[model samples]
Target: MTAPTDTPSATPSTPPDLDLAVLHHLRGDLEGAEAGYRAVLAASPDNATALNNLGFAAAQSGRFDEAVELYERSLAIEDGATARLNLGNVRAALGDLEGGIAELSRATELAPGDPTAYDNLGQLLMLQGRIAEAEAAWRHALAIEDGPRLRTALATAVAATGRLGEAAGLLHQALTLDPQFGAAWAQLGAVLLLRGDVASAGEALANAKRLDPDDPGPRRHLALALLSLGRTDEAVVEFGELVRLAPDDATSRVDLAVLHLSAGRAAAALTQLDRALEAGPDDDRARLHRAFALRELGRLAEADELLQAIADGDGEQADRARQALVDEAS
Candidate 1:
């Protein structure tokens, strides 16, 4: 169906069409919202609200550069904090960590004490392996909030930095504050694993799975805990179930393949890795695992071909492939 085709009739308040787009956004119809916003922009390129919301819509749709342009336009009209924050989010999502941090740094200048901004910084720092800076950001957020998500972020930050006990405590606190928080339970399990508390880790992971049946995180953690605890058969069954739940999640499939390899089931691992490769034809991660599994199975020629494809920049595995070749030579 077409939009209402209504245009703004008055000034000082937002356009009726802009309101409709926000409604569409609330209903999670991003495409519908995008269409509405684009129509509004056709008449008014300098509509800051429309441009800001449209940039967010584009970012959600994976058109990061388009989102960036819209954000810049919106900021040019008026220095909106959300526009800067979203530009930073899109930049981080596109793997430009330094650029993302720079954008966020500017956003902080605009709104010095925004918790969401700091929280975003923490997540980006974590991704870039800047554990110390990530922890500092999360702690700054903590001074303002003990919300479940903030706690979960704190748990991830601390756990990544080897503070497993503190991480586990934070996750447990988050879960205790809201027993239905699946993400907190999942993180708690992961922290427990780092502490070598396999049994408790399995329990917390099971709770996470129960709380959110659609989430794959708990299953993966449970599989890992089982494997580390010498329950290989059980771990294999759990990993197999993960493959069924998220058939196209290449990373989970790689975890399953690793489990199979550890259990001396190279052929089974190869089959799983093949499924991952098929699902993500251009995924360096799947290719890297396949090459290693093939090497272990004495298929050196096939492994070399796969690694060569990686080294030739067939995908994002060039760095990993080059390193693997070096390791092989040594």
Candidate 2:
């Protein structure tokens, strides 16, 4: 998991009781932390520090509503950037995107030098489809802290704006900053693929796969890159790995079936398609591929029957099925 943008820490003005509570929170002793904060609140009910720390504890325990109330009370006593940031995240978690953005924007104003506020604001903005605003916020964060994670985030925003070349450059810089960053490698590979550099994309995606072996995303893209490079066998291997990582993903199963059919492994393709259809019975693509697999297995009657059903249906798949029937008859 990524480290939190803001961590609660004891400041110079922090009271001893609040300081002890923070230590308990840091040690994962939530019950003890809450008790400690409650003890402080018993004597100082309006204590902003105690309220903020307690709110943090509540948020950690998935009590977003309670956390929001505590944070609001804390902010009423004192408007601090930390409390504002926490409120923003909790509000977002509770499905209040506009409210979250409002709090995070205030957090940025409260602490202009704090990169965490900018980074978090950018994330909320991105979620709202305000890509240009998100890019600007991320740029502010990058200016304050030149880190690989920030660079990768900025690269994603840049790529969304159709500047693939600049996005690739940012990803390259991120890689230079941290060579072991798997996400950067994956992003860079995807950008390269979009630029039509299949071989380079394959190399980058391979590195990402090696770094995070269980992640199906790099494998999925790498399979396509290998296919584009005419390395059908390698693509098959990658897609097989993807299937293992995400067994319930019917799309990957269909993709694997298509590859198997291309290699004349009709029986193998049929097995994958059967599983895909079982997982998603309404999947027309899988059904269509299954028909082709049947044809390759010399079950022409069954294949023709399935094709006729699909051709009688609506949309692009039906069109393809009609064409297949015409070709088979010809």
Q: Give Cα distance to truth, residue 291, candidate 1, Å.
A: 15
Q: Which stretches of candidate 1 lie over 4 Å from their true place?
A: 1-12, 29-32, 35-43, 228-230, 246-330
lDDT of 2 by residue, 270-313 (tens): 99999999998878899899999999999999999999998999
Error of 2 at 100 (Å): 1.9
State the displacement of the C-alpha of residue 265, model 2, in Å, after optimal TM-score superposition: 1.8
Clashing residue pairs for model 2: none
Global lDDT for candidate 1?
0.82
Give lDDT tens digits, candidate 1, residues 1-330: 011112221235988888888889878899899899999999998898898888888877788899899889998998966777788888877779898888876776787777777788788888888889888888887887668888888888888878888888888889888999999998888888878889999999989988987777799899888887888888888888888888988888888887788778889889988998888888787788889889999999999888988988956779889888888889
Give per-residue lDDT, candidate 1, residue 109.
75
Backbone-clash count (model 2): 0
